[model samples]
Target: MTAIPAVTLNNGVTIPQLGLGVFQIPDAETRAAVTTALEAGYRSIDTAAVYGNETGVGRALAASGLPRDELFVTTKLWITDLGRRAARDALRASLDRLGLDRVDLYLIHWPAPATDAYLDAWQGLEDLYAEGLARAIGVSNFLPEHLDRVVALGGTVPAVNQIELHPALQNRETAAAAAARGIATEAWSPLAQGAVLTEAPIVAAARAHGVTPAQVVLRWHLQQGRIVIPKSVTPARIAANLDVFGFDLTAAELTAIDALDRAGRTGPHPATFQG
Candidate 1:
């Protein structure tokens, strides 16, 4: 854990570069999975209002007996809760569900770009951050246009932008925009939903590094300066994912991965996120 690095956000806050993502993790398994991650030395946990397991994650955190400040928790606002007032109420509900008086980082899960309400939703987050209900604020799945809006309105630049990222969908432009604005980048599906685990280069790199293919890929992201959240219910994989601090991928290896990018996304596109 001590060997893991930290990324400085636009607000000058330092967060763990590698974190645990509990996306689609069943409610029954959420506690055990998050607890396993925490015990294995992960201090940052990324969840969302839509994930439907906030209570379980909350219970795990409470039961772990770890000091709150040492842990960084990130959660998001759902599309249905996009208006200013509705967003405010939604965050309070999320706080109640997570059993946290204030979250470390909060984000707009998606801009719902089709609608014009994300700006209002972002204002809600800004208000929350100003009132100390959230230590930091950011967005998720926001394309460059959405980010430009956040900046144009004249408020705090997002501390991070959690997005769909993997070797197959590198999101170079979005990541570069975030970097130019000093926003930290977090990858939600760093493993590509297990679709790329058997890719030749990943497998070869895994053998070359004497690590699992997953670890090799995660290390590649780490070396490329991206925050990653690799999810797993299995304890061994959870432990292995956090063990990436020990290695660094070569520039050529990273270039090989960059070439693997199909500009293909396996998940919903941000521009089409209606809710």
Candidate 2:
């Protein structure tokens, strides 16, 4: 088991830099997957209300027997639930499903700019945090303008901004903006959704590093200082995602991965996001 690294949030909370993401895993499979990840030494778990598997994730956590403080749990509010009243109640529902009294991190899943409810939603989250339901609060898929709006609303700056970031879509400018505000940017599709596993450079790097292409790609994310949540339901792949601590990428090798950036994004664009 590789030792996952940690990063200090803007609020000084420590989070495992690499975590297991339960994005599309079904309820039936999520429990076993999270259990496998935990046994493989992953301490952070990322899920969302939109994922519809929080109950299974909660079951896995309870079954692990690890103390609550030893694990980092993150969940999000869906765009459909983006009002002050709905947002407040949404956290409660998510908590009930997860069987956790409070979450390590909670987020507004998307800006939903067209819906124009995020500002009040931010206020709702602020209230929830003040009332002690979330240890830290953040956003997902928020671009610079969206972040500025949240900051302007007089709430604590979001502790993180999770996005689709792989070598194919590095989002350096967005990342720098988050850094400027002391918000840690997290990568969701950190592996390019597995589409780049066969790229020539990644393949050669894999051979030279005596590691798999997936490992090389994940290492690039780590070296970039981006918090990454790579998901897999298979037990072996879950273990493989966590087994990234033994090697370090050379400066040139890191540069090679950087060169693969083509402004390719496998997920939604922030500019066009409705949520």
Candidate 3:
């Protein structure tokens, strides 16, 4: 057990700084992946309705025998379901599939700006939060402009903003904006999808720390106060990802990694991504 640190969101709910992400894992494979993560001492599991594996995640959680309160489960509302009522219905459906009464955190999967339905979705999330169906609500892949608009609409400020952030794509500007509004930034691709594993800085740091490159990259995210959900289906990698809390990355090492940022976004642009 690595004793993963917890970050208290703007609303005062605490989330584990590191968690398991079930993005591409299929429904059948998701169960075992989540099971491996649980057995490896992970309490948080991040999934999206679009991922199409909440049912498998739910099955694993139900079978774990761990108290429901001890786990932090998060799922998102897909772009297709962006209206207020649609978002509400979508969550209920996700809840039904997950076999849970309420999700720890519910997020609008993306801004989907072109469609102009995110504000409505935000309202639905607020309604869910008000009714206790979602403990906390947030938006993912939202840029600074999107965040500003959501704030202007004025119902509930998002507790977290999930984005594609890694050493290669640090996304500091949006992160700063989220921080200014007291929202925590959650990094989805914290390891650059393995693109940065062989970088000289990361490799050097890993060798110095006697840890793997993946662990070094994860440690970089953790050391900077960002919440990370690194996805890995392999049991060894799943267990290794959580073993980053023991060592600290030096300031020079952090700076070297910071210099690696080149706006290399691994996902679609939020402003234009309809889905």
Q: What's each prediction's TM-score? A: 0.97, 0.97, 0.99
Candidate 2: tens digits of C-alpha lDDT, residues 1-275: 66778999998899999999999999989999999999999999999998999999999999999999999999999988999899989999999999999999999998878866988898888889899899999999998989898998866999999988888888888888899999999999999989888888888888998999999999888987889999999888888888888888889888888888898888887677775
- Candidate 1: lDDT of 257? 74
The C-alpha RMSD in Å for every predicted model, in order, reads 1.1, 1.1, 0.6
Tens digits of per-residue lDDT for model 1, 228-268: 98888899989989888777788777787778888769789
Our model 1 lands, by Cα RMSD against the true structure, at: 1.1
Clash number for model 1? 0
For each candidate, the alpha-carbon lDDT, in order, equals: 0.89, 0.90, 0.95
What is candidate 3's TM-score against the reference?
0.99
lDDT accuracy of residue 80 in candidate 1: 94
Clashes of 3: 0
Instruction: State model 2's lDDT.
Output: 0.90
Candidate 1 Cα deviation (angstroms), residue 73 = 0.5
Model 2 stretches with alpha carbons more than 4 Å out: none
- Candidate 3, residues 185-275, lDDT tens digits: the string is 9999899889999999999999999999999999999988999999999999999999988899999999999999998888898978886
